[model samples]
Each structure stands twice: as C-alpha cells, then as structure tokens.
Target: MPEAIHIRPDAARPIDVAVGILMRPDGDVLLGQRPAGKPYAGYWEFPGGKVEPGEDIFVALQREFVEELGIEVLSGEPWCCVEHVYEHAHVRLYFYICRAWRGEPQSLEGQAFAWQGAFGVSPLLPATIPLLEWLDRVRYAQPS
Candidate 1:
C-alpha cells in the first residue's frame, strides 16, 4: 500500500517576493534592517518587498529597489530563487544581483541600510543568513 500524504489543514499560500542584492565593485553588498512594526523587525535583510499580482518579477525587483532604496536600478540579473516559511507567512523569494544603479541607496522606509563587506549586523533575517553564507562561499572559491 502507498503511504498517505499528510497536508496541513491551514497551510498558507507562499507569497512571492523580489529581493535585490546591490553589489559594489569592491565586493561589498547592501543590507537593510527591517523597520519597526514589520515582521522580523530589526532583523537585517536584503532590500525587497512582496510582488503584487500579475507583476513581472524583474519589474517587481526594480520597483522594490526604487521604493526601498530610493535608487534607480540600471543593470541587474536574476540570481536565484528560494522558498522559506516563517511564523507569519510562507515566502517565495526571487533574488537578483544588482550591479549598477543610479543614486546612492537611502533609507526611505525608516530602516537602516549599509554597504557591508564583512556583515557586522546583528540578528539577520532567517532567509538572509543562507544567502550570505552562499555568497561567502562563492566569493572564496578558487578561480579555475
């Protein structure tokens, strides 16, 4: 007999999010602190937000960058996608590597943001930690 599949009665739908990692020429990347009154408040994360219905992921990424950082994304590409479940919601995050943008990143949402090479921030968001680890590993890899 086949094993029965057990599904949670209250399984939440995964919300699509577009995340932007702005990388400078010197290998530094941007990190932002979640503002008060939001989920995971004070936890550091990459800049991004939920993708609205019918919106293109790239369009969502550009919109989020401009809204959250006050910068115009000049060049970027999709890097990877990952799904995470938090106490509040399940999220499907689409990450993009933003290499060029216009204007300096500013905290427009009452959040703290910084360009970090060594990531000294405390309490990083759960989903962000793995990405940072992956980034470190990639940056440390020997060139073939």
Candidate 2:
C-alpha cells in the first residue's frame, strides 16, 4: 500500500510573486524559459520572481529583472493580479507593465529568452496561460 502524505494549511497560502511584462515600444513583450532545477523548469513565462516579505512589488520586479535578465527597470506600473494553484505552490502573481528599462536583456541565468510580438512559444507555464489571454484582450481590444 502507498503511504499517505500530509500538507500543512499554511502551505496552501498563496505566495506573492512580482511578474514583469517588459513591453517594447513596438508592442513586443519579453519572456524567458525557466532554468533547469527550478519549479516549472524549461517552461516559458514572463520574467519575474517571488516578492520578499515587506518588499515593494516594484522593487521586487526590478531586482528580479536584473538578476534574471540583467535589465534595470526604469518605468513600470501595476497591471493586474491573479492567483493560481500549482502542484508546487499557490501563487498570487502581481503583473506589471514595464514601459521603460535600461540595457538590453541578457540571459544572466543561462535560460533562453526572447522578445515576442505574438507569444508563439510552447509549454507555457500554467500560471501564465490566463495572463496571456488577458494580454490578448488588452492588446486587441477596440479603443473607445
């Protein structure tokens, strides 16, 4: 017989993550593949990381971008937030639209990355799927 496992209630609490959607002037956005040895490794998603305790989301965004992609975020604004539960953990993703940044993005973490006008990559992270749909709606919506 297989052994049963237990999960603590606090373990189900959603983790806060700051997600940076680095948008170029031409409407392209940046994405990066998850590095090997991380959760969701090899899956593509927007560049960002966990929000440290008491840390501002924007600060977290800038730090993560620099650490992961070597870009310094210059201008950005909060866009939206979503919560999702994965086998790994429950995450509350705070999405941001970064309009300005300094330096060209370099993959500092040995992961592949690209600027995409249309996200054509396969094996997108599950948490990012709905965010993509929302992006499409915003990008293609008729202006008032």
Candidate 3:
C-alpha cells in the first residue's frame, strides 16, 4: 500500500512562479522531469521556477531557463496564467511561450528532458495539464 501524504495546517504562503513553454518551430514543446528531492519529483513540467520578489516575469523566465536548462531565452511571449493549490503550497504560474532561444537545452539540474508533441504525454505535473489543454485549444481553434 502507498503511504498517505500529509499537509500542515500552517503551510507557507502561495508562491509566484514563472513558467516557459519552450516551443520548437515544428510545434513541439519541451518538458522536464522535476529533480529528485523537490516537491512533485519525477513529474514532468514546463521549465521554470519561483519568481523572486520584485523580479519581472520576463526576467524571471529568462533567468530560470538559463539556470535550469542552460539556455538563453531570446524571446518569450506571455501566454497565460493559472493558479493552483497544492497540499504543501499554493502557486500562481505565469506561463510564457518561448519560440526563440540560443544554445541547445541541456538539463543542468540532472533532470530528464523531452520534446513532446501536442498530445499524449503522460504523468505531467497537475498544474501543467491545464496549460497543455489551453495550448491545444488555442492552437487548433477553428477560423471564425
């Protein structure tokens, strides 16, 4: 049987996160597995991190890409925003679509990475699933 998870009543306040959907010209997007020892370890998520106090979302996105994936973001367009409440923490994620970047992405944090198509990738972080669905709807929306 699996161990039951516990949540403390006094969990820390919600975190502001900047997330990047690094998209290739071919319409695929990059996803990385969370490193062991972190919350939601092993689950795949868009490459990003917590937004430090007073940091702009764009700057945070660029910094996170370089810090986490070793790539310098050339351009990132604001895509969407979502908030989710987890047992341990609440997070407000600012999602960006990064279509341009320098250097090949390397997993500097020892986490696994993959380029995934529009659908069928499994076991994504709970927060990322809705973003993917939103992307699909926006990408495939019928002409008015």
Candidate 4:
C-alpha cells in the first residue's frame, strides 16, 4: 500500500474555494448556518466546504454534500462565482443550483440548517447575501 501524501495549504492558513449547493425541492432551497467556533459562525449560507487541489468544482460540490451534509447531489448546474476578501484570507465561492436529489437532509457538520423559499431567508452573512439575491433573481446573473 502507498501512503497518501497531503499537500500543504497555499497560505499558512489556507486558500479554499468551494461550491455551495442551492438544493431546490418543491420550489424552495436549503441553507445552513456556519457552526459556532468556526469562521462564519451563526451566518446562514449554503452548505459546502474547501476545494482540494486537482479537483473540479462540480465534483467538489457532490463530495461535500456526501461528506458534510450526508446527502447526494443528484444534479446541478453552474450558477455563479463570488470572491470575498476576508481579513484572514480570500475565498472564491462557486455556487450551483441543485436540480435533483434524494433522501432527507442532515447537517453532518452539526450546524443549523433551514429550508427557505427563494428570497425567503434573510439576515444572512454579507458574503452569502448576494447568492440569496441571485436565487431571488433580484438582478441578472451579473450586475449591469
């Protein structure tokens, strides 16, 4: 057997860009709050995590669903990408519109999760608010 060598982080902290699944069912979608003791604690946002090297964005989203949320991403399409500059580091978010899936949703990360209608959830984190607005179709895919 060969050992799987781990690659170091881009920065001392890490540089992670990931996908957030807007899992839609019956015309609504699910949102999860970042757990306490974490970077974006108490902020309601889509469920996802860090992207690994050599990994494609879509595959990362599917894997994240299985690992972090204990669900399967039946299908999704590329939605939008967002870049946020936090004090600690920068993150580029790739969001997708989950078109289909099965099984009940669970928060494997032990964070709070919610299902809200398009444009329903609010008071979310500044980073994710734009995504919510996109789900709401508040504006076109890109700002005019």
> Which ranges in model 2 have alpha carbons more than 4 Å from their true place?
1-11, 140-144
Candidate 3: segments with Cα more than 4 A from true spot = 1-13, 139-144
Ranking 1 against 2 by lDDT, winner? 2
Better of 1 and 3 by TM-score: 1
Clashes of each: 0, 0, 0, 0
Residues 13-128, candidate 2: write the lDDT tens digits: 79999999888767788989998999889999999999999999999999999898888999777889999888878899999888889999997899999888888897999988
Question: Which pairs clash in model 2?
Answer: none
| Per-residue lDDT over 4-69 for candidate 1, one digit per residue giving the tens place of the 0 to 100 score | 988773366789999988888777889999999998999999998999999999899889888888
lDDT of 1: 0.86
Task: List where candidate 4 sits over 4 angstroms from the true fold.
Answer: 1-16, 118-122, 138-144
Using TM-score as the measure, which candidate wins?
Answer: 1
Model 4, 1-144: lDDT tens digits are: 999978544334435666665544455667888788987678788788788998987888888888878888877777788877666566788877776666778877798788777545555777777665557762223222
Worst window of 10 by summed lDDT in candidate 3? 135-144
List the candidate 1 regions with Cα displacement exceeding 4 Å.
1-10, 137-144
Predicted candidate 3 versus true structure: per-residue lDDT over 12-52, tens digit per residue = 56799999988886678899998899988988888999999
Residue-pair clash count for candidate 3: 0
Worst 10 residues of 2 by lDDT: 135-144
